[model samples]
Target: MALRLAQILPPVVLLVLAIVGILLVVLPARETTKTPENMYGIVLDAGSSHTAMYIYKWPSDKQNGTGIVTQHSECKVKGRGISSYAGIRGEAAKSLEACMQEALSQIPKSRQAQTILCLGATAGMRLLDIVNSTESRRVMKEVETKLRSYPFKFKEAVILSGQAEGAYGWVTVNYLLENFVRYGFVGKWLNSGRETIGALDLGGASTQITFETAEKVEDESNLKELKLYGQTYKLYTQSFLCYGQDQFLRKLLAHLIKTQGVKSPIFHPCYPRQFNTTIKLGQDVFNSPCTKSYRPAKFDPYMNVTVVGTGDGGECLASVKKMFSFDNCTYSKCSFDGVFQPTVKGGFMAFSAFYINYNYLTRLTNISIRSSNQMANAMRLVCNMSMTEMVEKTNQMERYLKNVCAVSHFVKILLTEGYVFDEDAFPTISFQKKAGGASVGWALGYMLTMSNLVPAESLGLMKAMPSGTWTAILTLFILLLFFALGYMLLIYRARTKQDLV
Candidate 1:
């Protein structure tokens, strides 16, 4: 009887110990599995024409590549871009107040301290650097001061270089498009197909073109090797300073001024036939880096010129063609003005002023210049119209009504003559402001980089030890060991009972 009782008690104790060990393994895992709270960030895009603020959000625990960060909201500044406040330096900082308030309203108070804010000024500020260096620094400092006064964590406010602009723009489009190779444990690694589409940014003061290429790059300088999301890519890119719509218009205006002096009435094919406006063309117009060195030196005084519209699309196309010098070629391929560019590869997203002008070409104008041969056709349609005809046709204000032909023709020539993208490659380009419900611009990517969301090291290599699955497996092994020990005790107890019998 003593032996039987001992055997029974030993087996029961073993079984009880196994059950307690199993509970310890499973219960703690359940309790410890915590979902990381969400974090927030803000980015400001200070363009030549306007300033825009973007709010971004992501989980606090996921600071890996791309890190699940997405643009949560956007607010446009009350006035024009920060560069526009170059004259009145105080106003530059004030312009951002409206947008900063919106950001505070959008994000919660608890997360405000952790939230990071950054500002990036594009071509507009770059142009300011050339035109007025002292004013540029003063404006930047003022803007920075205003940003620091806010509640959120202010990172930096700086003018983005053309190279960083192009590279980051490419990252923005590809990130929004999900055109990246993703790796992690939650799901199988997803490859975003063959390659990423190129990015074409048409800002008011400058334009940027960038694309990933496997072919031999014509010029090494234009190629940017970037390590983002733990992957390396060689990109062919170039920023055409002063080739943007507004900048080019100035150059064209200067050329017109140099050719036809301000004292005389200038007939512009870019304007409507009945349209007439008095513009003071000062030395600022001709003295620009775009037109100054090329054309003759002129007086800095304001020269009044009456712009009378002459409806001739053919004449307008011919006039715009002169702005681009497609002559010198140092590389195997060049875009324009002797800038090296590889063949435009993959698809491209043409944004900014490109979309605003060309998206409504056929639908609004009741014109069908869908193809490149119709470049001059769209130009002609806008050029040949009278001011009253345009006002009646578009039902818009006079300020909006003007520069129809110039904007339309600028897109045409920039695509065909300047970038060398032929008519057949037209389908490869998409004119869009947003993709997948997020704004398609460099601001998002710029913030991601500055906040360290885009990591430099591989996630797999960065791990000190395996996580998620490995931890689970370790817990599972301890559970199995307890069960094994219980089984051994049960076998020994049974054998002891048998021997006693």
Candidate 2:
């Protein structure tokens, strides 16, 4: 009885437990430490016309926590975003390799980076084109292989989606506003009687509108409520899509004729402003002398009749007046109705006349199109304006969307559905860009945040390990433990026999 039990006991308890403990560390926590400083993180913000690369370090002391990350030091390289549309293959690899080398120069040589994470945006995610049809099942494979060719032991990259970018922007904006906005810390928006606000972010290819109010997230439970201005929008509400200035314009021109019921105009050699005119059927019909440029052989019926023009440019503004001429027409004025009319609020005209009553889209569209050009131009317009002026412009834009566009209704819908997701209810801002300029502020902020959270060594372990290997490990341990016990038992039996003899 003792021998039989002994044969099974060691394998069942000690061996099994030992094997499990090893697996707990090996399977669940397969994290391996990589060299510090040598772990390089590359963020490729691939826009339509340009690509920007930002490099970061994985610090040894980083830890996970709440609150906004502040450090942003990183090396940046141009020529990677939308311009590298052919998926990161061939020439793409060469270009990125050069960028990697250049980035290496920015960091200290004493530190070596062991892992590389390359994140691609826009084109890589949305508009990848196949190069040489002979290769892989997916286009991204080409991109993945090329990026992985880097010298680092661990090389991984991801192309972000449109929704992802919008979501990230929403998170970033809220975090920044929470830290800098007035009355932000009091969580006044969470109070039953506090005012609320909205936020909008317009990127090169997409725009996001967020309607937010504060809610009380009890330390004890998972509940929240939002307060918007005097009313509540919800916890958070937002909408993001691919409707942007350049894309909108291109699509508009592509669909003009079928939607308008007019023959396509010839391409006018004159400036865009001079092309605006009142056409007289003139009893002569086909005899009208028109430019050859605007003429399309066929019409597109799917055209969204709403036109969105860049809101910031006096030139763009001039172009709107000259081409569409909505300021003087009676049919186009007095109300925000009509597909062709331009609304006069928010210091600009509404493009999608349908959204005159939709606060989220209207407000976001206005900010997006108005400030659509570039940061420099938008900043210049407000350079001479006092704080009052800036606030007035901002508030006026808000009121215009709220009152004229009837944004409250949509905001209410989002509230009911619980889609509004701002950290707080008000618009808060920090002078990150201004203290050292926006570019430097962005860089420093990235560096500080990356250093505090990521440890370079765990990159490989994170990438490996699928599942279902535990059964094999357990069986192997049981067999080994049984063998060792059998040998010991045999020796004891042999010794007993010898003593008896």
Candidate 3:
């Protein structure tokens, strides 16, 4: 009986080892085949013109050091930005309700609590904070309260500094362009080793320029350092406040009113020859800090002034040029307004108002802007179009159509003169509204950093051995176990037969 038990035990042990070895190989393979759960994040961009909400998602198991975050959905909050709701309590937070509700349907209820939600107010709030800190704090608190009421894990509601905004935008641009890290053909995540592109963001109240630069940044404040996908980059970033499309227009209008004198039928060189509009001195033009210096000493706040279009392209360019001060440069190099900037190197992605104006100009004139001359020619055609011709050609609203020429020229000057992108460098600027299916902006970058979605180091594999090596070893072990079991059974059977005989 003891001999019988020993024979059976050896075969049983071999069978068990074979089963264990099979599972050791098969289970990990199964895990690798299964899809990872997805994580979600929400970012609300509250700009001066309007507020927009973006939803982003990524796999739970990140590849390399970065989450493959992509825009899941987006909602544009109706009405103006949160700052516009200032002086009216609770309205700022109320404006975000529609977008937040939309987010509820987009993100799964199960993952809502785990999902991160953040709100970043840009130059509009920054300006508001400068003008009225009390109102700014109140708006932020109200917005925070509204966000907390939702199911998501509320991160924070804060006004992003100009430097932070610029840096984050740079990240967004490069991340979308796959300049940091990319999946190689070898089924592994690899550093792209591609030259990073620059980001040129034109919003309602500010414009930001950020790029990787090896040259020494003259202004320490303009220099930013970032680590992404295990790669370090030294960046030069500068945000010019009150230089956005809307604010620049305001400044331009104020400059016109100040230069031509506040009177009926003020001639505007940028507007179309047939276009005319009525604007108030204090409310329409001088209400913001950007145009505060140009406010008339004795004009009524509600006084109406008529603005007539002269359709002069040359004068329009000259007038836009005056808005920038290129003389006082304390640094080795300056962009415009005496701000320090390294040479605009590499390709650039210009978004927001830049793309908008470019799109309108291209559609109106059927001209592609590749050089300074091309842009100038496009502006001349757009500026010369009549109000009726513009409406017919573009099929856009009169309000938007009227300002196309001015905005286009403003963009042209901002790029060629302000940012110092000369003739040769001009073609490198690609006007784009979106990249990689996501809108080009700082919101994604902000969410990425705040949520720790991007780690400094790549994620290590779960198993120390390669999957192929594990498979080969496990197969060998199983085959050996099978042979051993077969041999032991045969031996046991032979011994039983001999004993029986």
Candidate 4:
């Protein structure tokens, strides 16, 4: 009986080992450590308006997977963006002091050295570079110096490219939406188009549009290849410099300069009918790449402008439409200015200056826009309001306060004419500032890529298991081998004894 049992045990042990190994190879992964082990990361979004610091926390064991990192906290710096310090010098780095110190207080001291610190300047810096590369470098250097003072591991302080801005913003939105893992799972069973939403970022100096598509991108410059969460996507992305809200105003002002001089008060259509503000045609206006070589003879160091609003939505739309060119496209299709774009598909997420007005304009009452007409109507309502009325409604003039009407008109033209989204599709486009407690921007995407969260090659179950899980697996194998060998030896000894009998 003992001999029979021993012989049976050997085969059973071998079978158990094979099953476990196969299971390990095929099963989806879960947390390796039940006890949470946390890690920290930091990214600074230096925008045209201001700089924001994002602190993220994730279980150290699941660094490579989606939905693991969560926004721990955020600190908005107290002053203007880093680029604003270009002319004055040194203040840009000084501006980061309060925010970096706040980061020190938020993160535990032990993790400080391991935490990463990066500064990615966006359109403001990009435009700054075009205006004065020397000034741009000074600003970057000053900011870098300040970031280096912190205990966190300083990685990079550089101007981010337009392609990176668009692609990374798309990654940020999709990652928070958990589209990477969803794509990974669905890709196994379906042959279909990408389901990730597109991204549109508007800043002081530029605007970016990026999305995934099956259409061929004839302009190689406009297409970018990205691999995230174990799936590959070819994205269409473009940045229209001098097309951002601030820069667009600069262009309009430049055109206004041609028709009107500093001596005569200029009447503009975008402002309220009674709105009056003086604008200087200082070098700041014409020195821009947007105003390159288009200096009007009437230009002077100072200019006064009286903008008389024509709250007529048609006129506002028409005026905004002139900023775009519909005839220059060299591709199969164009979204103005010859830029290549797939027919706009999926819901879009816009951020920065011209962000979707979901949580914004709260003073205007709870107005949620689902169609272009709704947007147009809402903007007209606010734009037509006198400065006194508008101030009372919105509390204060945000940077774009005066040009509310033009902004709304620009949003319509940019989306409908520039991106080819119909009026009804505006409902699908959500304008938000944050996702999953983090700023809904490119900073998080920058950190994810720098951290190597996406592996170059696919692993069957979301990359390799943690070291603890690997150890448990190894121990199981050892025990199985020992049991198999011991059972075989016992069976051989029993057989010899029976033969002797």
Best by lDDT: 3
Q: Write the per-residue lDDT of candidate 1 for residues 134-191, one digit (tens) a residue.
A: 9999999999999999989999999998878988899888877766654333333345
Worst 10 residues of 3 by lDDT: 458-467
What is the per-residue lDDT of model 3 for residues 1-501, given as tens digits with 9 covering 90 to 100? 896788678778877877777766667556457767778999999999999999999767764435668889989999998999889998888888888989998888989998999999999999999899999999999999999999999999999988899999998888787777664322345677799999999999999999999999988998888876567799998899999888999999999988988888889998899688999887779889999888888888888999989999889888888888988888887888788888889999999888898899899999977998998898889889899998898889988988888888788778888888998899999999998888999998899898886666663221123456666877787897878778787987898899899
Number of backbone collisions per candidate, in order?
A: 1, 39, 0, 2
The residue-level lDDT of candidate 2 at 406 comes to: 16
Models sorted by lDDT, best on top: 3, 1, 4, 2
Give the range of the ten consecutive residues with the poorest summed lDDT in model 1.
457-466
What lDDT does each candidate get? Answer: 0.76, 0.34, 0.85, 0.73
Which residue pairs clash within candidate 3? none
Task: Name the regions of candidate 4 deviating beyond 4 angstroms.
Answer: 1-35, 63-67, 182-194, 303-313, 356-367, 398-400, 456-501
- The alpha-carbon lDDT assigned to residue 51 of candidate 4 equals 87
Candidate 4 pairs with clashing backbones: 329-338, 356-431
- Tens digits of per-residue lDDT for model 2, 69-91: 33234444555443343533455
Point out where model 3 deviates above 4 Å: 1-32, 63-65, 459-501
Candidates sorted by TM-score, descending order? Answer: 3, 1, 4, 2
